[model samples]
Target: MADTGAAIELVGLTKRYPGDRQPSVDGVTLRVDAGETVVFVGPSGCGKSTTLKMINRLIEPSSGSVRINGEDVTGLDPVELRRGIGYAIQSSGLFPHLTVAQNIALVPRMAGWSGRRVRARVTEMLELVGLDPGEFRDRYPRRLSGGQQQRVGVARALAADPPVLLMDEPFGAVDPVTRGHLQDELLRLQRELRKTIVFVTHDVDEAIKLGDRIAVLGERSRIAQFDTPEAILAHPADAFVSGFVGSGAALKRLDLTRLRDLGVPGCPTAHQGEPLPQVRARLRASATDEMLLLDRRGRPVRWLRRADLTHAEGPLTEAGTPVGGTVTRDATLREALEAVLTDSTGRVAVTGPNGVYAGAVRLEGLLGTVRGLLAADRGRAREHQRERESTRPEPTPPEAEGATAGRAEGDAMGSAG
Candidate 1:
């Protein structure tokens, strides 16, 4: 609703339960900048979840401090402190008895907002998460799908317009396909909302896809590596971090890189009702054998070839195969690669936010661009190394003069003899 985000800092945060010999989360110190999404990813029992809870004091840390925008909040009243931050968890944590609107209105209403403001905020949040407010406002948690429940949970979390959000595996309970969609939705929301997010997950791929920086934790919340996704993928800090990164690091790098950065080429396109003769001429004029058909709004609808149009159909609407797959510019190269491999044409259409056709991408071009980028990065690295070496001063040793004099004396004695 508002551009609200604050930096979060954890200073030696530790959590120990009574009668336990060791702490579950020990000495976890990190800083998250405002509007940055930092993901804590590690193996099970690594205390990632425990570390996240300490930030919001869900499970208070036995020691250490929590700071929000340079203000230490650990000593504050936990109830009042929590009211200012948003929290979402797996299984949605939505109340079964409450309707969607009521669930979203909880925070704002409790914060002393007027009824009119609360109602308006509920509608705005629902729409922000892509749900029709009119239809879903009255629905309960049990009546919604797994994905829908998660959306509602997020809406409720953001209802109060909190400056920071703590999400502990919020999409873990959904199916893989739905989980992917939810991840995309979160990315879209972050683009608009820019909330300082600390996400906890066990999925490294998910971390790479969503995080501005990733903290790979070890036992007792030990941070093995804390760096950008690209840095972690290219050069892991140690053996544990390398193993956690798993196989296919190169492919994972594709996820960090976007398609728009590669500069996708445009393809021939025609409107839905365009004349067949004109479509055929356009397709022939183009280098490729296929052309994309767009509806009135310029969204991709179908793919066409000259052979499919030989029958002379009435409106070009049903002339050819449906546009089986498409990707947005924000989509990763890995996603585009998957779409390309699945398509029969060895290419995939790219669309903008409004689903309007933007461009097309091919397998060869995508791979070549990645290779060029990698080579360029290497070249820059080598150049940097050479510059550093050239600027470094040479060292002179005190013993060098004596050693040289002794060597000269030995040579003179040998010549005289």
Candidate 2:
């Protein structure tokens, strides 16, 4: 919100320690656009975390430059530079003696905000992070659960409304389920805040899920590859990057695509008191085995199958099998696919805003989408191979020739979801 999120640039950024044979980060160079989330991922001692800290001056670079929003960071005071960037680390990092409200108010208070404004900010951040302010405010950090403490850490970081956020495996300490929930919360918050985020994680899956562009790091924090997740998935720069992505690349791509990307049709729907004849006609026209029944308010109530209609149901609500659940339009393809698999008729219900019955995504229709996406992804990979070959001055490397026959990797670039 402050003059748009900061755009970060690291040119020849290097850090070395006394008695070290090699620099921890060896002349790393990268650029992060305003309001983008770029994750640095690698194994331990790869310089991923070290490079992340240099952005906010948590660790001073021995040489080179760091810039935020086109201004050099080195000339500025380290404390002031840090104050403008939000930082969250593992295990919440909350002071056990401080109450939740106090923890969140720290930055705002330091920035000389009035007491009234600080309090208002504390309450607002709590709500933004999905915590009940009244119930959690007075409680000390020790009273909160792991997940709750993580939320408070995020709220504290965002309290000052900084233009950049530095996250160091922020969700790493929580249990698997809690970690997943925290990731979802972070993603939702990002959609609203859109801060330039530099997140450091050793987990490839986490990096793929969170980053708009992922910087796959190698020894000494060298950038093995830096590109969009789709590009990386479709075209790994080298064997190291591909090996780092590991197996299940195709399945992982599914989460990146949303249901709306494909115009998946929905089954017919009618209100509870609608005329049976009209509802019957609607169902017959769809040429499907079932239809969705909606409440008077347009929310889904149940599924009306072919057998129920043949029985001449008294009302639309009383007709067809009851709807089990509904998938929102914004849901990912993996979510929609799961719904179809669990659904009795293999016809998943989809909803519009506010749970209104929207359309049905039949299993057959969903499969067609998957086939098309996979095909396109393979095609792109092939094209990338051709381009690389044409641009190379020497003979093609065996790795470049690893294209999948007629298919290219970029096919899954956007539609994999």
Span of 10 residues, lowest total lDDT, candidate 2: 405-414
Cα misplacement distance, residue 200 of candidate 2 (Å) = 1.1
Candidate 1 worst ten-residue window by lDDT: 372-381
Which candidate has the highest lDDT of all?
1
Query: Which residue runs does candidate 2 get wrong by more than 4 Å?
Result: 1-3, 260-331, 335-366, 386-417
Off by over 4 Å in 1: 1-3, 273-287, 296-298, 354-356, 377-417
lDDT of each residue in 223-285, candidate 1, tens digit only = 999999988987788999999999888678788878767677898999977777888888888
Q: In order, what is each prediction's RMSD in angstroms?
A: 6.0, 11.1
Error of 1 at 190 (Å): 1.5
Clashes of each: 0, 20
What is candidate 2's TM-score against the reference?
0.74
